[model samples]
Target: MLLTKFDPFKQFKDLERSFYNYPSNNESVNGFVPIVNTREGESAYHIDVDLPGVKKEDIKVDISKDILTISGERKTKDEIKEEDYYKVETSFGKFTRSFTLPENIDIENIEARSDNGVLEVIIPKKEEQNSKKSIEIK
Candidate 1:
């Protein structure tokens, strides 16, 4: 039988399990992880992403079926002479973020814009359906 009770400790259990699968420090990973924030409003969903030092033209946003994808590359500034740099910490590379949009979204009405290194994607929700009809008994 399936248990219907909700356990408050489930989150802690999941976090403990994740610790066992953590990546090693020596892993070779490319690109920086752009911070992303998503919020739902009364009529739409807003996705805010931070892409510092990346150009607007370099970014691409597309929707395939119900999946929304955002991709871009941050090119490193002109190569610096080996002796000219004391320390380089800024990350520059390609990065992509994708999301599976829900059925409530109005796909045709989605829009994206960028300003001051911030990208905003607005996803409008479709009007709710209310077409229930009473069937006349024979």
Candidate 2:
């Protein structure tokens, strides 16, 4: 049998090159779902999303059939002169994210607010089923 030598450094270099050369689509890409932390309470569910560089007019939130969708676009500045020499590494494009709310949520009472680059969504629980309680035996 013939033995072949494996070069790990060469493989890593190829991976790094590929990462830098990755293509970006001009259309919106829903790659990152917001960091969601669900807390069980007697009244409602609160969701917060970190959305820096997004303007109030550019953000859109929609709800349909128990699904909530959030989308926004961050415009890039065009202040770089032709003679300027430097590196640019900031991302500028459209992003979208969606989530399906549980059945027990009250769709009509859902509310959203944005302040200081953070978005907060409040989903009130349904009164009929969410308010029901069960007795536990010890």
Candidate 3:
């Protein structure tokens, strides 16, 4: 006997994806999706993307219309002899990820850097301005 976990909405999700031609959150159109982690701090928000085989030059970060997009491609080895490999599981393809910037973010100060195969995007929040004012009526 085999026990399997069941999800009642799995069928509905599949139907929706097929109807709308959309990829699931964990799957990308190119078939390679880099894992990402996000954190929010008092003064800034950080997004960390794990890209094992992708080079820094291949990655691109851009912002347009309040959307931050990260795109890159992972290239395979120059030559691979099929006979020499019993199994190859490495994924290679183009990948894209996007995030919507919050209204309180300081767009001008956004920064991105890559180190040890991790790409970190830092979005600094704008300092809050005191809006309280005294109004005198005649």
Candidate 4:
């Protein structure tokens, strides 16, 4: 006898990825969906997001209500004609991505930098705060 476990929402997740035209290949750089990598260490969280062909001036990063947003745009050629190009796969226009930061993050200590079409953000975790309290009875 053999038993197999089934995932009820796997198909739904696949459908959602398809609906948004997410790239099938994880290493595809020309796709509309930029690849993102995140890592957590004892001191900080590191994030690397691929944003090819995007200008540094066009990129924006902000934190609002504990949500971190990274946004940018890639400009396409303006004079290219339909018959001039055989094929095109690069993604253009504005794209935005948001992430919810953990409570341990230090909002003011965050740092970001962009180099060679890749944006890197470093978020340092806040030191543990004392929560113990003594109340006097009235």
Query: How many pairs of residues collide in each model?
Result: 0, 0, 0, 0
Ranking by lDDT: 3, 1, 4, 2
Q: Which residue ranges in model 3 land beyond 4 Å of their true spot?
A: 1-29, 136-138
Instruction: Tally clashing residue pairs in candidate 1.
Output: 0
Worst 10 residues of 3 by lDDT: 22-31
Give each model's whole-structure lDDT: 0.88, 0.74, 0.90, 0.85
- Root-mean-square deviation (CA) per prediction: 12.3, 7.3, 7.9, 9.8
Q: Pick the candidate with the highest lDDT.
A: 3
| Model 4 TM-score, all chains together | 0.69
Which candidate do you rate higher for TM-score, 1 or 2? 1
Residue 13, model 1: Cα distance from true site in angstroms: 23
Rank the candidate models, highest TM-score first.
Answer: 3, 1, 4, 2
Query: Model 2, 1-138: lDDT tens per residue?
Result: 999898869988998999776656422144423344455568888777777767889889999897888888766666965347476444566777788889889888888999998888888988874666889999
Give the C-alpha miss distance for residue 52 in model 1, angstroms. Answer: 1.0
Report residue 106 deviation for candidate 3 (angstroms): 0.8
lDDT of 3 at 47: 98
Candidate 3 global lDDT: 0.90
lDDT comparison, 1 vs 2, better candidate? 1
* Winning model by TM-score: 3
- Report the lDDT of model 1 for residue 116: 96
